[model samples]
Target chain A: MPFPQFLFPNSKFPSQVRNIFLFIRRYFNLLLFLFLQGFSIYLIVHNSRYHNAIFGSITNQLTGKVNEQFSRVEYYFQLKKTNDSLVKANAKLYNKLKADFELPDTTSNIFVDSLKVDSIETYRKYNYYPAKVVYNSVAAQNNYLVLSRGTAQQVRSGMGVIDPNGSVVGVVTDVSKDFAVVMSLLHKDSHIEGMLLKATRKQAHSAGMAWRPISLTFPGYRKVRKWLWETASYQVATVPAYQKV
Target chain B: MNTLVKNIVRFALFILVQVYVLDKIHLHQMVTPYIYFLFILWMPFRMKRTWQMLVAFALGFTLDSFHHNPGFHAAACVLIAYIRPFLVNLLIPQEGADTNYEEPSFKSMGGFLPYFIFTGVLTLIHHGWLFLLEAWQFGNIWYFIFKTLLSTAVSLVLIVVTELLFARKQSFRTNTA
Candidate 1:
């Protein structure tokens, strides 16, 4: 039976059942393609709510995995600076303790200087858990930093990341079994609460919104601070100065 | 049937790859690659021109949903698909291209000349239009050119490599007079 029979009335096969059936089948395939493609475009133009939900959670999980793998690589590279920041941070807390008259000075009993840490707390008991950067995306428009710590490690979302110098880095976004994603200071998406050291006030984004943070991204703000501090050393990201975990 | 199934698989795979892998390759807050349009390039040669443009748009929208610049890739893809049939006809001679003509294939499309010329031109147009849509400002005009070339080069490499290794065993489907 020759295909494409019913469409044209000028058929010569005497309209056999087999030929008519074949014609239907051929047209059906083409029709199905048209219907499906039209439906696809309809779904697109209408911005159907169904497809949107499917992607958000799927990519979130994938982004989490990708961020994890990347942070592991970056964590390895930043190990040395992480260690030095830890030691220096430790010594800083120690001097503050002695100045509070809680420790008997051995060398000179000159542990008496009015520092902000002392003002914030007579004994500032801040604990940092040292976790590697499991995923670090310095290039994403909405970059995130994932750590090797999670809820199991007592790390919660919104916990501020501090550098060795006790500066702010980012906040915990997602928490897994033993992994957490940090929305880094460099993340164009994140604008966490931060303050200037010298003025001790928050330097808002050029838009002048402190709480409702916009993209006043501090790409080189920390470096500028490091230079201002008379330290031509290096700059750090989300985990601020010497506060290591 | 096997080739049809293979093409289906390739289409799905290409979309997944563009969304999962390529869109993540942003640099300096720019550099969006328009490689997803390669799906349009691999369509059956004799497919209707209008359908080709329509499918190109679907492919583009799928990727755009996963990207920052929504509708940018979709619009560019439509332009490419619109120009594709004319471009393909221009590059390949219509006479000897017989039944079961493999689309843009090295064997059926008369070796690499027509295939590369057609695909390369369409891809550049797609990428160029896409970049312009995303970045219309003149402040970073130099960067835009670099981005367009970079994206076009990457997409072209992907297209050529895909055609060489993964192109389906298309039969002579072109209905010639």
Candidate 2:
């Protein structure tokens, strides 16, 4: 090794130092690859454990914008299907409207108007806000749905999401400026309690846990199977934090 | 200038198709076609390896953002990008003989058989790493293997079809450039 004597005139390990530099220069690509791989693994471990605070927020905003735009194109293609579902939901709601029914004549009977009519405010416990699903996937173990509504529209984490027909969709997990991430019911960690209306007399209840074969395949738990199978008609509403089922 | 523009367009097209179209098609829970790695695979051989890895990281990170899995794709992509030059050298021993071929394609890799093998091996490695990181356990080893193999098969088919469709056009453009 013809080492430059001027740079390290008195150094005893100058040749070794030069060799180290040569090795680094020779395999710099491999070093870079390992560094990048380690960075990616770090990101995975960090983001998978808890809500990512730094890069997550920035990437979430960008992905939210792009998905929102892409979903518009998809929404256009599915306009007919969306219109049909909306019509069906409309018909169902229209039949339950107060204007569709009239009180029968009760002239022969004594009328009692002791109950206060303006007490509906006490019974109104929940409010529903409409939002579009900008992105959704059922293929992953931990599936998440992104909604177009976010903090801008008063959407907050821990809020429940429901479809047009009032079926449980998901629960809000993260919120950005113009978008929110919902942990869908198909996720492995999503646990929901489903009540069986037909067994109301018996007080039979079932826990609706998603993606668990033990819950679905248990032979003795016919009630659980029935509730899980009747996903269309049966409704799972989010109970208030203060209330217990 | 033309090659740069062409690669940029290819990058956008690959990301869009992979995220929007291929992701929506739920063929099975185990089989996901990840043909987006073809962007890195098709990168020019003359480009620096460090730059290739960086580009692969960006591509994988972009896909990861959309899928909500932050690092799995990025790790797999970087690994493949790092190994791509070695695979090319092993497969095509002669260097200056095919100097005109700017990128690896059917014609550049000598023939369809070599290209197929090259693509299949890389796809297998990429999918294996991704699915392994995704499952992150050996409890279901069979499940992991099946998922990797099935996804590799699907991705290979899509990649070969894409190459067949666009390889000639790419070679023509490279020649003109």
Evaluated with TM-score, which candidate comes out highest?
Answer: 2
Q: Residue-wise lDDT of candidate 1 within A76-169, one digit each (tens)?
A: 7778988888899889788767556755554342223345445433433346777766445544333455566767788766677755665555
- Predicted complexes: DockQ each: 0.13, 0.52
Query: Over the stretch B11-103, how does candidate 2's per-residue lDDT look in tens digits?
Result: 889888999999899998778878899999889888888899999999999988887768889999999999998888888736553456778
lDDT of 1 by residue, B10-53 (tens): 67788767755665566434455545677787777767665676
Please list the residue runs of candidate 1 whose C-alpha ends up more than 4 Å from where it truly belongs after superposition.
Answer: A1-194, A198-245, B1-4, B15-35, B46-58, B61-70, B95-99, B136-139, B165-168, B173-177
What value does the lDDT take at residue B5 in candidate 1? 85
Give, for candidate 1 chain A, the lowest lDDT window spanning 10 residues. A206-215
Pairs of residues at least 3 apart in sequence or in different chains that clash in candidate 2: none
Q: After superposition, how far is residue B4 of candidate 2 from its true place, in Å?
A: 2.7
* Leading candidate by DockQ: 2
Worst 10 residues of 1 chain B by lDDT: B62-71
| Local lDDT at B42 for model 2 | 86
Off by more than 4 A, model 2: A1-26, A49-51, A95-123, A197-208, A212-233, A237-245, B137-139, B169-177
Error in Å for residue A106 of model 2: 20
Residues A2-44, candidate 2: write the lDDT tens digits.
Answer: 3355665555566887778667767889899999999999988
